[model samples]
Target: MGRPKYFTPNEVSLHSTLGDLWVSYLGKVYNLTPLVEEYKGDVLLKPIIECAGKDISHWFDPKTKDILTHVDPLSGCVKYYTPRGRFVHVPPPCPRTDWCNDFGRPWWKDNRYEVCSEETLDEILKRYLHYNSHAHSYTWKHNGVSLDMSKTLSENGIPDEDEEFFDARMDRDLFSLSICLYFNDDLTEF
Candidate 1:
């Protein structure tokens, strides 16, 4: 089934089961059913399964979009603060030779698990149309790459620059970032 642009908390709660599990963190909902299927019977899945269909926003740092971490007093080392206990992807407190690090990236960092974001590219384009009537004829892109209209700006590697601009104390009109929009040749005038 195609994922929706938004999922209510109740809708997420409905999928809390071993066969199907979903979780939301840092304002993005993720369907982790495939992870469960892949790591079935693994002890690390206990914490994830226990909080299925629930929002785990508290588990992450909003700025970094990573697990919340703190310095371990005993070892004076920083570690992920998984109160529910360290699950998959999180390294053990003490290094263990048996521990695996072959996984390229953690599940949260993987886009495959993403189900929804705050706004989609389609919605953003519609908003642009309000200002420019011919916006529909232009293909959206970032860094010279075409964007997927079904995904959000962040998913397309378009970082929000408003904060950076504001930090520099530059007026929006004086320092504008350019987004090259090429009119689609296939678009026909009616």
Candidate 2:
């Protein structure tokens, strides 16, 4: 093996732009600039923009194992490439109480908050990779085909009620919303 590379936090901070964005996870650094164009309008884009040129080690808990792979010649880091681009689809409001509970009040409700446009599936995955490995339970693969929620509940040994509770609390749609009146400008106005 060759000698490992080293980068200071300041060095990482200098690269925080769409043209030269870099982020450090674990002990390695990845250049995310190549993904900038493809990730435009994605919910993950906001976090990526915020985290550009920073050591994201603090954002992730150290207990979690590395869920991403590292490729050589790419600075021994994994590139953020999602084959499906944005995976979470913001479905139209459903009448089911379960759905409403997971996504907060219905969009038509006066108290309903405006959803953040930048809460993409990739951002959720990044959070999962950093904080809770168990969140991976929401994903699985079978018979040469992969499914996102194949094991969301079963692997965790969670009861149906607990699963519903988890969905209600951590569901991407609800978690990313801001209590704002106008969906465009007033992201924080309640």
Candidate 3:
């Protein structure tokens, strides 16, 4: 009934303390303070401890084996449980390259796009337009709509070169320009 709220990573960081735990997953922010308090003594705390106040998109990614599992201290039974909370939409961090595109092609082989460190939003836009125009082999869609990458980027404001915009779009399940410098190649080697 009200306007949706958004928070920057810095804002989420303000609530990172254990007493006021908050974490971001898939561009959604969740306050896990209550769950942490409830499961204080459970082994489930391990994953939570690792992800508190951080963007946990990778944890939920299908390609990765980063699931949260807990062991019952008394019975030695292992189980998995995710924290429950009132999650708000926030821009998520960039995803891993392997998870960026549907195609099994390596990033370099796909387009050889290199996100420049000093690249402006305009530069990114130009690259997107070029990619969309020339690369017809792959079609990127959001909510079943074939994305007009240029139109979407322009509509969102072209001057925004901050990493936040990229993260936000990814979180919203929008288009992914995994070609950006924000997602470095330091991850798993191809």
Candidate 4:
């Protein structure tokens, strides 16, 4: 069978949407099922893989057993790996919030901040690869997806250097998914 083609990383909604899907920030659904109640980045995969019913397991994870450790390759977050099946969540915000790595300058400046561990990096890269080639514009996807104009830069809050950085998130900061979360999927066996 042919591989699935994804919308290009240009699609802000799609990029942001799928990025969130890979690592949700809100909360997990009640039980577990592919009928994910969370929009994106809602800890859907791990819960579904760990506590979900048997129906949708195959589509998400079957033999994978633990899903929390599963992260998107392109998401660019990482942490230490433990045998307990516990994996770390490594979205950009985590490094900044928890590790204080994002205090000054854009994240691209520091190698330490980029250290999402070797394994975790590989995983995120693989997931990101799923959409690198596909031609779709994130710019169009972000349009009115769930935008709030009032909260964009506060009277040109974007500095000259920072503008380029923030702009990458959404179309002109309109849909900046600046805040996101990761999952601690139940990869470990009890």
Candidate 5:
């Protein structure tokens, strides 16, 4: 209901992961992370996973506001044209009594998943201090390299690649890029 948030393609690309997947469609950005959690390990998630953090406007029709359709050459039947392969919320090629539609609104149409902007390292540090009031001065580092407070994580050469680890079925915490925070003594504090 507030002002709509805007994000650059580069910023969106930073969230490409099962833990934080995002995609833009019809000029609207969506955080499909919940969908991934709900339908984890489903093959239908393959296409969506493959397109994480990228624009999926081509996956949808501009006018219909839905996935594009094509006539099947084999059966001459109309079906959702998913060149990337069928994904979640997309009904099967044929009617099935077992198909459940109780999910209410589909992920694409739900506005709750719409995303916003990001913050710089300095802003994040401020937030950290806000939560940890006992902290005085602080130093942020990635890969043992001191971070430039004015720059973002990506701008500082730290790419969020949790998705790659997830796709490889590896534990993220085991090999995740962690930002180390060193508490500095406030020499002037009185």
Candidate 6:
């Protein structure tokens, strides 16, 4: 019962693999655990293919930066608001570090968002990867009775050997501002 993604018990069911559906979905070569397998269809590949019309490593980040500025599907608006007021969208992998929304922080005292942006393929891709069971967290806050998205992928896990490369790219930013950025879902994407 969320925006964009309408999932109820009747539309889909994953608890029972229904024969070898789960095992077969993940080929033996991947050696993928259940954590990664369940999301491959409904959350991962389906969106990727739907977006770029290809299954390439679109999830993988490059040395360059990507920009995004999508409109709000719910409000039909194209502006972002925070403690700092409104702003425009940037592409993939925003290097913004000044965002102050800390509710999505891993160390936050309490989470409050039910879902983030999933209006378009790009937004969905970013949130889906970050919201996975392992790589990122589904944070929330309450605007009255409504759940607000605190989707974040700022800090987690071990860094690659090339620490400088990752450092220059990620900017060590948190998910206070729900902008379009490359969610660090390395484990799930692979």
Which pairs of residues have clashing backbones in candidate 3? none
Tens digit of lDDT per residue, candidate 3, span 1-190?
A: 5333455567677777768887765445677776667557655366665666777654453323234455657667654434542122111123344332333542212222221122333444455556554333344443444445444343534333324544354443353344222223233321
Worst 10 residues of 1 by lDDT: 164-173
For 1-190, candidate 4 gives per-residue lDDT tens digits of 5322222223212312222222111111112111233223444234333422222111222222222243445665543222233212223323354443333532112233211111222233345547642211122113234222233222223322323433353233243433122323434322
Judging by TM-score, tell me the better candidate of 3 and 4.
3
For candidate 5, write residues 1-190 as lDDT tens digits: 7544457677789989999999977656889998999999999999999999987876776667778899989889989899988888888888899878788887887889987644677666555566776444667888789998888777999886644554575554477467887878764321
Candidate order by lDDT, decreasing, is 1, 5, 3, 2, 6, 4
Tens-place lDDT digits, model 6, residues 112-141: 212122243334445466565442332232
Instruction: Tell me how far the alpha carbon of residue 161 in candidate 5 is from the true structure, in angstroms, after superposition.
Output: 32
**Which candidate ranks first by lDDT, i.e. highest?**
1
Shift of residue 100 alpha carbon in model 2, Å: 21
For model 2, the superposed segments whose C-alpha errors exceed 4 Å read 1-4, 66-190
Error of 4 at 185 (Å): 54
Point to the candidate with the largest TM-score: 1
Tell me model 2's lDDT, rounded to 2 decimals: 0.43
Q: After superposing candidate 6, which stretches have Cα over 4 Å from the reference?
A: 1-38, 50-67, 73-76, 79-190
Residues 63-116, candidate 2: write the lDDT tens digits: 432222224353655443232231212232223443223534322121211111
Cα lDDT of candidate 4 equals 0.28
Which portions of model 4 show Cα errors greater than 4 Å? 15-190
True lDDT of residue 43, candidate 1: 94
| Pairs in clash, predicted candidate 1 | none
Model 1 misplacement above 4 A: 1-3, 118-190
What TM-score does model 1 achieve against the real structure?
Answer: 0.61
